[model samples]
Target: MALVTGGSVAGPGAVEAARWWMRMMRDPLATYGALGRRYGDTVRVPFGVGRALYVLSRPEHAEHVLVANQDNYVKAFTYRPLRAVIGEGLLTSEGDTWRRHRRVVGPVFAQRHVVGFAPQIVETAVAAVERWPDGVMLDAAGELRRLTLDVVGRALFGSELAGEAGRTGRSLETLQRGAVIGTFLPGATAKRGLYQRVPGLGGAIGQLDGLVQRVIRGSSGGELLNLLREGGEFSDAELRDEVLTLLLAGHETTAASLAWTFVLLSRYPAARERLEGEVDEVLGGRDPRADDVDRLPWTRAVLSEAMRIYPPAWTIERDAVDGDDIAGVRVPAGSTIAVPPYLLHRNTDIWPNPEGFQPERFMGEQQRHRYAYLPFGGGRRICVGAGFAMLEAILVLATVSRTHRLDLAPGVPVRGRAEITLRPAGPVPMRVSRR
Candidate 1:
């Protein structure tokens, strides 16, 4: 297949292309940002001899690849490493396997159904927040991870995971780092057995395996778990895969986004005040219910703006199954295209003052392109847990805002770590004060 020729190539020469590849392996988010700044929205970076990787940041690119002509694209080769770990779960599975998993797992996250979990989410958040001593400096990222894990555990699996969050978080860090590194290795290295032989990854996998087994064996008949067990569709191995996928996907992204939201609120006190004002006026010192989400538009907007700035799933990539013209760019079959939300949200053409933390952008009416703000991706393959995640985030944010305020600890440095998810690189040290 011929490489894409229509778009401006980021690194046209072989030597420059190799440098770009090395930069990508080292820091993908920074590399993508630099490529976008230099090459504009659509950039074709030469991969191998005749192959090219297209970094498309335009909303139209997202619309075409993820929606309009979506059938022509499939998840890219980058997901292979993740697949080896999660097996045939929804996040990595494709074709018939994906269809089957979605069929069984999708309904639980349906808007109406997800609302049922709101009580559990808020309750878990409140309990976790209450445990924090007044005016104590804590790792907001770790705390949020533990809280989200607990919510997902009790709400969906009827198991308690708060105790395991620390180890699970470390395991996930190892897995994500390993997965990214594994992506550059030979195809055979993507195998689960091969990953198991790797030093730290083996223990990480063991921890995750132990967690999944705990959920399966210790299940106390939570609705989602009951459905999965009674459905008679998934075998033991498939059940383990789905459970692990849900556990990780359900908690990790939400935790990261919440941690970022807290950090952003700390940095931008005016935004934080506005959010707290809205939460106070709306809730009046009561825990947030699902129905309260609509009334508290500013809370939702804060979460939206936070996600816009630091999207958990920063990149969405796909490989073309057939050659086609995406807008004006000619993409050949097998071409890999990345429609990164991190770049799209920051595309100056679409978002004015893209670097600013403005929750007002999501308020009132939005006239931008349908694919412009893709915190949850687009098209049929969009995250099934999108509704659930949003509901959980809003409730947790509102619940925390109702009684507590978190500010970045003095002189602490925070940086984004772009791996499987875009989360804070290290602990987000923040002091929590009771409001």
Candidate 2:
């Protein structure tokens, strides 16, 4: 019989080990790195008497786990906590609901649709840039987060959300930690209750719910809410789930990705110079339009390289459907399978000088393996907004690069906190000056 591991056991790979649980509670990136270094890529950490985890980082392993034989796995137990908070949203839902959500929401993120949203994106970036005072140090991460949240707000729901950015930002922080906490507890019901009891999270979910309801009610023009409301075969609960998913998923990640890109550019002057040249040539003197993105190759490449190094959607995990061997270890059914993009992107076998910042890695006809560089993930469940995110990030980066140069104040240590998505630990302090 295939083993189904879901409990505490202090054996060869005990997930209950203090170090393992500490890593789970605190720093997963370091923990994963230590595990990979110590036991190789395919280390299994036992959870209780039955459940265990398999952390794999190689390209072939990622391919086999996330794409090639993906049918053998389902979204891992880690996502379960996130689902509890969002509830059947596009990112967390599975089965027929996921298919239907994908079908209806997919078109809105098409290249044409995404490109058409560029002007709005530029307008939002410009507006945020306008508020920045020279010599004034601000949280660059927070600012970009606000800007992208506003863009997602206006583009998807045709509503303005800049005012709620601060409150919403804080709320999301609480909700993310709660997601990890819920993963240890049993069932979605436990998570839903925990979210209510948590202070910042409870307020945040309430506000997000309020905001979504307003958007759904107030969307007289946008395609997202309309498609969600009138789309056939979508239940009301599923619609809310998807709306919440898109609202959070659509913006938070792109915002964080841009934040990391700008931070990297500030630290790397040569890279910034190249980015500026590309943007200047493409845009000339006018604001960019949907027709203009294709010509901005270097700008796009810079964004690509940025995501490769610090992918906002940094980790992808799955659980085996049936007990099976991957790489070498025989993973029991119900075991969590982790193939972190953060770790995978840094795999030296696939990326030369993996930790170095080099936009040129994507410049020419470099033959890259299909699953080697999966910033947007792979397989049927790959991020539906991948196209939209790329377009948005590139356009925003170009427009901002054309107008302003932001640098983190010296000695300001920027740290990333892992959440439902990876984000700056707190504020990313930077000085914004006109380019």
Candidate 1 vs. true structure, TM-score: 0.98
**Residue-level lDDT tens digits of model 1 in 23-58:** 988899999999888767888887776777888898
Q: How much is the lDDT of residue 342 in candidate 1?
A: 98
- Runs with alpha carbons beyond 4 Å of true place in candidate 1: 1-11
Predicted candidate 2 versus true structure: per-residue lDDT over 296-381, tens digit per residue: 88888878888888878878989898876665556677778888888888877788898788888888797877777888888888
Cα RMSD (Å) per model? Answer: 2.1, 3.6
Clashing pairs in 1: none
Residue 68, candidate 1: C-alpha displacement in angstroms: 1.0
TM-scores vs. true structure, each candidate? 0.98, 0.93
Query: Relative to the true structure, how large is the alpha-carbon lDDT of every model?
Result: 0.91, 0.79
* Number of backbone collisions per candidate: 0, 12
Error of 2 at 18 (Å): 3.9
Which 10-residue window of candidate 1 scores lowest in summed lDDT? 1-10
